[model samples]
Target chain A: SQLAEENSWALSVHEGESVTVNCSYKTSITALQWYRQKSGKGPAQLILIRSNEREKRNGRLRATLDTSSQSSSLSITATRCEDTAVYFCAGMGYKLTFGTGTSLLVDP
Target chain B: EAAVTQSPRNKVTVTGGNVTLSCRQTNSHNYMYWYRQDTGHGLRLIHYSYGAGNLQIGDVPDGYKATRTTQEDFFLLLELASPSQTSLYFCASSDPRWGGRAEQFFGPGTRLTVL
Candidate 1:
């Protein structure tokens, strides 16, 4: 069983469009991190939002964390084909617990 | 950036076979981890270590044993391989000083199959 899970299984959007992936966790966490995994590669961290912070941004990626609801969202703007990857939200508790991930395909 | 590498990017074995997955980290971080990824289960922790000769049981550690021989090397042993063990495995390293906030750096990954 997964302690954290993404709400969407898959999403599709055209290049230059915007997309959002949401996640929910079952336990308390110190921080939440967003990671992207491309085909045949390991995941790489994209953003980290702390429990005390509501939002954080890095380049074209923005992440919002709501402790009240134990949910988080990652939004990408002006998406590119390179952004076609599986997005995962990992909760930083005593140990890192990851979600199943949301597969996002950016079509040109 | 940190460097983590896993050997034998792909492996295949039979039931009850012996398999060992190797991982090495170049960056001198104090913590290392092993995780398995399946279609429905994204990434489940198998084992972790804070230092050499130290091992910690993770969320899903059944049928898996891990050893940290040195600061840079970590190994996962599957003495009796099973079909359910067929999945993509990853290795990661982080600094424990940061506790839960520590960002983990991952290796490329190893795909394993069991008959």
Candidate 2:
């Protein structure tokens, strides 16, 4: 749960700009997942990166995992206002633990 | 698409009151999980089940109990609700056979308020 923590509490960017949310975990993880939660909805998985791989991508979303540093990052390219949401990074091994989350506001 | 639904989208209960949140997933996934989300703390797992009649403890299980009656239905019970338990609850289901259960289908979520 608290083992994973996001670096920033919030960030703001304009439309068409790219933004990244970072996370660090206290323990080993087999995989790292980035999830996005919009207002009034549950969190949805965006991308999953394995420890063996350095990066993974889905559509406009990209995820990178650095097992050696116990860190991960999710980057969104050409963000839209609809992309505004709380982003969380989850560490998955025997159990799945989520980071606090970084709220990203994409301004028009 | 995988579908998961939760009942009583909003709930308000007083201290010492009892509350139960219902969830049903049409995904036919074998694993279901219950989690609570709050400011700063993010999502903390309360409980989970691999199948019917099987339950597993999660990160935060002190004030909650859960039961999986069938493959599709899982219920979370709060016998004595407290203000600290006031948070958004979400139900999710996934199949372990898929890339270590990375992708989970989640319900809309139940907003619980305890006074």
Best by lDDT: 1
Fraction of native contacts, model 1: 0.63
lDDT of 1 by residue, B84-112 (tens): 99999999998767863478889999999
User: Using TM-score as the measure, which candidate wins?
Assistant: 1
Cα RMSD to the true fold for all candidates: 0.9, 1.3
Categorize the docking of model 2: medium
For model 1, the stretches where C-alpha displacement exceeds 4 angstroms are none
Question: What's the TM-score of each model vs. the native?
Answer: 0.98, 0.96
Compared with the true structure, what per-residue lDDT tens digits does model 1 show for residues A2-91?
A: 778999999999999999999999999999999999999999999989999999999999999999999999999999999999999999
Per-residue CA lDDT of candidate 2, range A20-107, in tens? 9999999888888888999999889888788899989899998888888888888999999999999998888777788999999999
> What lDDT score belongs to each candidate, Candidate 1 first?
0.94, 0.90
